[model samples]
Target: MRAGPLVVVGDTLLDVDLQGTSQRLAPDAPVPVVDLAAERPRPGGAGLAAVQAARLRTSRETVLVTPLADTDDPDALKLLELLEAQGVRVVRLPLSGRTVRKTRLIAHGRPLVRVDRGDGRLHGRTGLPDAAAAAVRGAGAVLVSDYGRGTAAHPVLRALLEELPGEVPLVWDPHPRGAEPVPRARLVTPNREEARTLAATARTARSGGYAQAATDAAALRARWRATGVSVTMGEHGALLCTGDQPPVLVPAPPVPGRPDTCGAGDCLSAAATGALAEGALLTEALEQGVHHASVFVAGGPAPRGSDTAEAEPWDLVRRTRLQGGTVVATGGCFDLLHPGHVSLLHQAARLGDLLVVCLNSDASVRALKGPGRPVMGQADRARVLSALGCVDAVMVFDEETPTALLERLRPDLWVKGGDYGPLELPEASLVRGHGGQVLLLPYLEGRSTTRLVQRAHSEGGEER
Candidate 1:
């Protein structure tokens, strides 16, 4: 299910998950006393869609045009950084104000409260940069996630859409605050509530006409002049309507247990748009999207978090493999992440569905590079690596070689940077013996950590 060239345009956000436990109640108030321990940050909304679609590896190229305000918010920078790390080409539209950020306080694995920061004035420039428009024009399919941020309402985006080629499939996730599509969208997806409003606004439907899903979808299709309309019904599924055809009732697969539904819609739209870009029929794309959404919900925060707040285990490899996607593994010291490291990681992610980075522990790094090395602690290194979008999971291994870990995970592919395997490489043999492929990426010239360390030492720097 390889996708062709694809583009995703819309709001970009930083989704921060704060995890901890509330064991005691406050004396002054009834609120539980929570001891916050850790936080996880992920790209949200349009950014997330772009990343997930890229993970499908359906296309030779995928690009995300997102408004990124120039700011010093570390978390926000992290969000944008991960997009590229996850292998999605980025066209950054400058925003004058701060980017939107959503932070949640969670007890166990569920969100207890959410705190959103940022004024509604996230727009700066009025039009898409020339590079952005060209990128969209070249895309096989375009997905728009209008989260009511300014990107969806900008003149440049609207103008571009108005002039876009009709053959380019457009999957639009509409929001109330966003501009309407240019009457030629391939599909528009709105939640039940949003659809009701759209139906009422259409005025063709009498009062309370939204109750009839078909009528509402039809009303919206006509109102937006889109080719098709699908109204997502949270628990039930979606009502898909195209032209004169009777709307099909697609039942979402049942989940056995409670799963996180937070970003299910984004994932659904992303998957479907990618499928559509690859020339899947509308029905086929919808079916695939529905299944992808269900699986995502079933796999979400139901059991990932813990009181200890430990990172996900390597054991998830088996689960991911079973789900049928490429899994890539890379082993390295990763003492100080450099440009070359970033490039390697992004390339690695483009090669697979998920990438597992096997990080060498402090002892192992010390043994390999001798004492007075690493510069950064193992925990620090792992934390930074985990923040990368391309590096889906990071595991600290104490062994000198990742051979044992590779044997355990048996990834679909193994990637290493630089070209030095000599006559025989042990890890290569391990990976190849398990019916897996191995590849070596070219090293970014003059971008090694050792060179930087040496430069620092020459500049009166000491081994910390």
Candidate 2:
């Protein structure tokens, strides 16, 4: 099944980041002194969750419900821009209080301290307006991301859940101290420590051995009326228990190299939500979620020291330059990364010293093609492209046209399929402007991504 429309509600936050290199130790202490390089902010809390959902549900409609203060925080604007770029419809609930901002202090690539700013109060206690309620009602599934910032309190959540039909799925990631007994939720995900806490509270009237753990978890699920319960155990992996199914244990995959564990849980929750929304069974969704989480935890770039880390854009121009070799640059969605794409890449590599393939990010793909496009994700596509021996580098751009990238790379020769005429190609001018030649390689007749997607759909293949 293809992913369907999703609604996300909960606290929204701003993630303020400071990045730099440490050149010397602090005079007062042994801590390294960091020379700031760049500063940026990303959406956090429910906002971050919404971003992940947008990626997974690239082909489906997405709506976000959160309270935001009308303020001058660039971080807030950045977050909004990101959501808009992803084609997500954000329904902002006005709040007089400031948006939550978590600022991290880093030196030499390692985090030293984090400072949080904002009032920890929930806004719009009157309940979701009729319009917001209608939006949630129209969604196929709903996810609540609670960060204990008061946006997802009992009143708002209850109102939203009450509006959802029973068949429409509801998943909850509860805040540590939020109101409990989430009656309408189909599933509840809590980490091992949180599970233990819930268990201890449930058994306050009874005493038992280690069996108390299982008993408590089951009791909590029953009390909440949730069909499924998931307990994330970090490196130990996760355990999923459903009412009628046997408990399933999913072990964590080995990381290729040590990686920072940040955002793994968010990735897991997002993947699970996406799979469930797509109609996958609980077990199947859990497996895919674990797989996605493993990839994130294993493949993220390493941190520097005490300095905040940022991902550097892949330098396709450098990689496509081989000694005494010609360079070929091509850009596209490359959605399926099929054998045809492999053949074209190989053919392009043969004509040049190196092959640099630029891919459209999920957002760009959606803008170019209507909804229900890009059979694969940007990260997945990039990974596949990088793994190919014929491909030298892969870069992701969130633009309808790759003219800017073409200008930056200034390849010796820019190549595209003959399907497009030179007059219609936007990158042609950029390549020519950089003193680079443009070539139109003959496209494989009768072999195109559109045809492949149509055939796959006809054969009952899942859209995503």
Candidate 3:
């Protein structure tokens, strides 16, 4: 089964990156004149969180509840189109002013200057729409991406957020100017500077260094009445404080150089919220968030429109299809990741431009191969598969068969490694019905997970 829909509530903005080459200073002024090459526009703030959520949880629905200017406004229209293209469903609230847009001038992947303009605000008189309220109430997990643009401060929306059941995970990414998160929030995340400011305003002790951040986190959690508080310290990582337990520090993986961290915070919150929606423990969620954010930053900014490290599988499929490139897909448990699997995947990759692996979820693997099976969990398995140069994307499915996922992907070619043919294979008919070709290649001789496991057990008992 798919995870419940992810609801991101807060303000939305239009973010644009103007990329160009800057070689020398202008003759007229001391400033360097940039030769513009490309313009990349993407959803910002809550819209960005929604896009990130959708990317991380490909099987789950991601919804954004925020205000937007009328479609007549070019920036707003662009934001809507980008969010839609990213597979994020937006529930637009009425806006009282123009859409907020931020433009950054970049040279060689580094931002030179950022320009921000807009007066967009949620219509103060307009109450939360019924549909948006329902979406918030039904969400499996909620992320309040407060950009301090009034949506998080709205009384009606805040009221509804306050009433959400405790069972639903609530992650609040706070802004200095935004309204305080509801007392029911499960987690409150604030950057180092924001945390320091909030702590000082509350008449709490203020000190320097990472040790002080831990103190700030605990103070903020108590003051906000939240279940946990995490203070994010850029490259140093995040310190998480929950309950009476000792704070845990989740450090960032080392990157070679200074990474452009413009949207790294949103990336972190979105990843953590996605993990929570998938029923991961708080600590596990934070670990995943830190790792994803590091990866996102290390990959550098998407100089163009496409995100480099965290590109959505759906987006890849659409782009490939648009270019008339053949898409190939294969499904399997992929436990242990033996040489047989690698050989088959490499052969399949040769048949198409992009090869997507439909992996069986942990639950599905357990049900099919028994409890002791799947030596690696689904996430680990998927990570290993994605690291393979031959594999383009990894899609996990909970069902016994990947029929539903196949229906969604509708690849041009379906490949499997076995002795089965069109008739013996359960998914062959479905593949053919969709006008897709199915090919079965012989497995590498004497290489299988079952045989490997049996040998391991036999060898263990033989001696040592």
Candidate 4:
């Protein structure tokens, strides 16, 4: 069965990073002067939660339910576009003020300072929109990513949240200034500090570190009437408390360096929400959340400059689907790049917004085409295909067929160049089962890899 959308309910913000170089100290001040470089902007807060959740989901599968200001503020408009571009469907409510924007200045890859502005909050007199209410009711899992921007405090929304069915999992990521989570929240997430502040008991001081986090999580779980509570400890990971059981320590994977943890909380919450939406147990979801959040932090906050148009194969597929674009995939040994291969790739590219070539691994190629086959190594073939304008990405698979990769990618179109019937192919049923179309494109005449190989051998020429 298809999974329902994961609804992220809270405040959205615009986050920008101003990256630059810092050199000699200024003559007039003690601080060094910064030479400006690139400016990167992305969604923050609930918007961030939505974007993170959308990473593994298809277009419109992650919904952001937030209060958006009706004004024409550039930051607000930009945030809206960015969220939509990442495949988040926004269900906007009325806002009483300007949208929040947080700008950080970074020099030499380290954050120097942060400038925050905007007073956006849910309008006091605002009523829940029909669409927003409908989204909550239809959510497979709900994450209240409250940033204390008043969306979580809105009475109409709070009432709606309280009325959700028991089967629906509700995760509340609390903020200091946000309203308390409604009763029956399946889980409540709070950082180490927030847990202490919300629980409001000096007993937390009786312990320190993980012990304190565990105590606070347990206290808050009971106080807030939530089934489970998780206290996130940066780098250390999270402490989960549930039903009088001993707290579980879900450790974060160790990274080589101190990584930027700007959105680690949102990443964790979003990952857990997505897992829960797909019916994972709370413990399993938290484990996934920890792993995903760790990877997210390890990747850091800034994007590395890319010199090529091609992206990682999985990323290409995810990004295409997120942008509501079609993804096309084709598979082959591709031992030798030939005119027929290039022609098929070109045609596949035209059928979708992105084309991923699933190349057979060296082992798989040998298995399928004999030991003497695969004139080129898998790595060289992947590199060559990635350099092609018609190919957005290349994925090498060890399996005899690409059914496993097809299941993972779920491409919109699976194109194959041959004279064989399309439905008879091994991966055709798998692609069709996932709502993808399979098409057989005609091969270029007089262009064959085997023929080229034979000619090269007869002429005493090495394979190209």
Ranking the candidates on TM-score from highest down gives 3, 4, 1, 2
Arranged by lDDT, best first: 3, 4, 1, 2
Model 1: worst 10 consecutive residues (lDDT sum): 301-310
Error of 1 at 275 (Å): 0.9
For candidate 2, lDDT tens digit of each residue in 215-249? 55576788788888777767656677786556777
For each candidate in turn, the TM-score is: 0.63, 0.63, 0.68, 0.67
Regions of model 2 farther than 4 Å from truth:
1-4, 72-75, 154-156, 201-216, 299-464
- Would you give me the overall lDDT of model 4? 0.81
Query: How large an RMSD does model 4 have?
Result: 14.1
Q: Give lDDT per model, in order.
A: 0.75, 0.69, 0.83, 0.81
Q: Tens digits of per-residue lDDT for model 4 on 323-422?
A: 3578889999887899999999998889887788888999998999888888889889987886676776677889999888888888889999885576
- The model with the greatest lDDT is 3
**C-alpha lDDT of residue 397 in model 4:** 81
Residue 34 in model 2: shift from native, Å?
1.1
For each candidate, C-alpha RMSD in Å?
Answer: 17.5, 11.0, 9.6, 14.1
